[model samples]
Target: VQDNLEGALTEADIEPLNMPEMDRDELVEGESFKFTLLCQVKPDIELKGLDALTVNRELVEVGDTEINAEIEGLREQNAELEPVEDRGSETGDIVTFDFVGTLDGEEEPFDGGSGTEHPLELGSGQFIEGFEDQLIGVKEGDERVVDVTFPEDYQAEHLAAKLAHFACTVKSVRCKALADVDDEFAVDLGHDDLSALRASVYDRLFEAATKEKDGDVREQLLKGLMEANEIEIPAALIEMAQKQLQNQMGMHLAMNGMPRDQIAQAMESETEGVLERAKEMAHRDLLLDAAAVEGDISVSDDELEERIGEIAVDMNQPKAKVRASLQENDRIHSVRGEMLHEKTLRWLEEQASSVSGDSTSASAEGNPTADDASDSNVEVADEES
Candidate 1:
């Protein structure tokens, strides 16, 4: 006979429970046993006041100042450095030099104390604050001794707030020539003219701002929904979420060029913070899933395929290749879950009331762009175990 105290539970489902030990010798071969299994189930999440939730959508306006800033950035990107023979070192000029630094009255130089043919930008503040200023009037071949004090919070503990002297030699100076913001620059960047480039930039910025605003509104709605709902999350789910977070963090570090040893070291210091964040994320995801079920929201195979196609296009890969890779990595479910979350958020947005603010500009901090929203939806899809 099968155990029915917990209502037709299998071994896999019954693992996370307090079950009493059973002696196999007490039963014969092919014989069954009956026992009680005490277990906890997923809590019921009642999402209320969703329709009454009010969120503010900040409308960000692209102005002339932002447009000009973009133009300036483009100009900087197109700038060229030309050697300057007539003038001494000055702000905005690149200076090349050699130097040996030592602490006061010390015969031995400090660690990382000497370098040759080092090219530095005068006003870039790459060196200590006073070190660059002392080189302002120095000519080529001029030998000078620069004095400066490291900041109290300097990275090197031994050098913190320490006075140091550098015996320096001026080598060469180069000034940057920025390309003019005109038709030629526009043509070089594949645009028709200056006006055309400006218009394109404005359109792109406006689109980004709009997407960012939508993301902010969605976040506010999610926060409101969570506040209106009360539920208890399972400990097993939290542990699973924490493990997923650790894996994601490791992957992120590896992708960003962090070595295995360094990643391990960094993770050691970040475990507590990561676990807390995992709990919060897990709680939010549980609430979202419950809300989706209540609203009869679901992801279809066609919808999942469409999203996969979009991903392939975005990544510039073949559709079949992308699908194969996702399948190999077992991330197809993640894509489906992300789509479902997106649909749920859209539904929530429609059901709730929103007010557009009168402000013409706003920062996009803590906001989600269309791309961010998509990532957020997929982030927890495969993590839920």
Candidate 2:
């Protein structure tokens, strides 16, 4: 309908207000028919007095303390685990075991409550609260009946708040041996030496801090603009925005170990937050589009070629090949849109009084730190990845 209406009515953009029902029963067979479409154009926004808006873009400080912490994290990641055969299992040890669980007083083991030779880090909270504590003193080949009560909000409907016992045996206990932070450690991680590694980490950290500050500035600009010019969001967009956000939050919870069966209930509990976020998304999109028009932000052929040339360099492919691939995948417009969006945001950032960002316009030629894969940038790599 958007394309057809745009062609018929000569309108550039059209947003449908509602999905109207059509009457087809009265049309005769082989007879010519005509239909009219009624679409509500989404509001075109005007960004006025943006130059007077004051949004603080505090520059994040990158200190030696932060650098040291990041380096320490790398050291921890490179640590090796060594078996401790002489002692019984203790906190911080990785223990391997087998176990079967039954309801506190039941005669038989319960379903989905047994494991053999599973390795679990003691005190990691990977299991029920009391389960790991019981393994703390158990030696290899030792057996103990461990008791624990499931949490009230446990995902399993039948097992929530229930007590269970596991007859277990320990196979081994191991402790981590942290690497020494030295030139050798840096060399092992493919860096020339400790100094070189620190320099690289520093550069990376500074870049990250800059990007974070830039994002904060953009957010404040949009928030101030939206507050100044409020519009009621249509129902269709509200439903769409709410569902996408709800699913995203639910997926995050699931990835962090929440069971799927309870995600629906958890999402239901977050109805208000989801609605507000949905409204914010819709509002930001509207304002950005309006700002794009108001500022006349566009991606000229030369600017697009410049961005694609950079993309080709990043992808290690020739510019011609990369452009061909993008065109083949129907992603040329998406790339253009991303560039346009960035240009629009850069325009808004220019209006701010205090911002920690590059003075160069987004389309300007330079080693732009913008690998900004717009919402569309996500799709270009789908088939290839």
Candidate 3:
């Protein structure tokens, strides 16, 4: 009877508010048993003020200075390095040499203080201050003792702001030949001419800027929606979101080449910080979910299949395989939740008015902050699902 009741509730798409309470009567052999079951229904949510929200939309303009700087960056990327046998080291030259550094009153060189055949760009500021300056005018086979002081905030505690002497030897020198921004350079880059290259760069920059601005607008809309609505989020949901946040952070760290052990250590050390972010994320999620319900936004079966197909294409996996993987991992609901969230945001955006004269102009060469880029992808709380 208990099994039948549970199965029936699941089939009806009903979830108990808490574990069901059951009362049973003892029965003799071949006699019927009696039982009473009690369950609580989910609470209804009332969402308000979604249609009256206001959000600012930013209009971004890309300037010529930004385009010129982008072209210069391309030139730098394509610059050729040629051996410089006729001259000594100069600013902007790549110099190869060996060096050994020692502190005052030290008999042997310090740890990580020596190297051989190290290639460094003279004006790149890759070494300690004044170290590269002393390398200027040094020719092949020239040896000298260079003196420099480390900054007070150096990573190594013992060497911070300390004076040191480096025994350096010049091995070879090379200079870069930067390509001119002309028609010929455009041809090398697969463009018809300089004008074509410039147009392409402008288009890409404009697209990036527009995307960044859209993200800001979306965030503002979400913030407005959140401010207008107040809802109680379940503790269970918060815990799940926190775990999902940790997993995402761990994945990000691993993707950036952090070792597994180090990633574990980092997660351990950042527990409170991660939990705080998780709580905020979870709160936003609950608000979005309530709005979705109130607005009657939902993901259809066909929509889910379409989304899965797109993911398969992006991941270069077979659609059937990806579908099976999602089912096996019980993540189909997570995708559905993400789709619902997107729909809610779109609905809110339609309801809100974009404030005029709030547009800001910025350089194209400068990258957007992490907050600006955060909306490029929507991270669903898969664990919560």
Prediction RMSDs, each to the true structure: 10.7, 10.1, 10.7
Cα error, candidate 1, residue 207 (Å): 1.6
What ranking emerges by lDDT with the best candidate at the front? 3, 1, 2
Over 1-385, each residue of candidate 1 has an lDDT whose tens digit, in order, gives 3434335465445534233334333656797655444455556677788778888977687755676687778866777888777767788788899999999889788878799999988888999988899988777788989999999966455678999999999788777787766667778999876666776776777778888888888889888977787567777677878889999989998898776777887787789998888778777887778879988999988888888999999999999999999999999987887788888888888787868773335444323233332222211111110
- Candidate 2 lDDT, tens digit per residue, 1-385? 4445547654644446456433334566897666666445566556665767668867466555566678878865777778887777778778898999999879898878999999998998999998899888777788899999999987676789999999998777777776666667779999876666666666677778778877888888887888787887666767767887987898899998776767777788789988988988878777777888988788899999999999999999999999999999888987997788789998997777874444222212212122321111111111100
Model 2 ranges off by over 4 Å:
1-6, 9-36, 105-112, 246-272, 300-339, 355-385
Tens-place lDDT per residue, model 3, 1-385, is 8568888678878776556678879968999887766766534567677777888776677756566677778876888888887777889888899999999778799977899999999989999999999999888888989999999966555688898999998888877787766778879999876666776776788778778887888899877766787666666666778989998998998898766776777788899998888777877887887878777899999999999999999999999999999999999999999999998888887788877544445445433333332222222222210
Order of candidate numbers by TM-score, starting with the best: 2, 1, 3
Task: Tell me the number of clashing residue pairs for each predicted model.
Answer: 0, 0, 0
Give lDDT: candidate 3, residue 209: 79
After superposition of all CA atoms, the RMSD between model 2 and the true structure is 10.1
- The model with the greatest TM-score is 2
Worst 10 residues of 3 by lDDT: 376-385
Candidate of highest lDDT: 3
Q: TM-score of every model?
A: 0.73, 0.74, 0.71
lDDT of 3 at 310: 99
Model 3 deviation from native, Cα RMSD in Å: 10.7
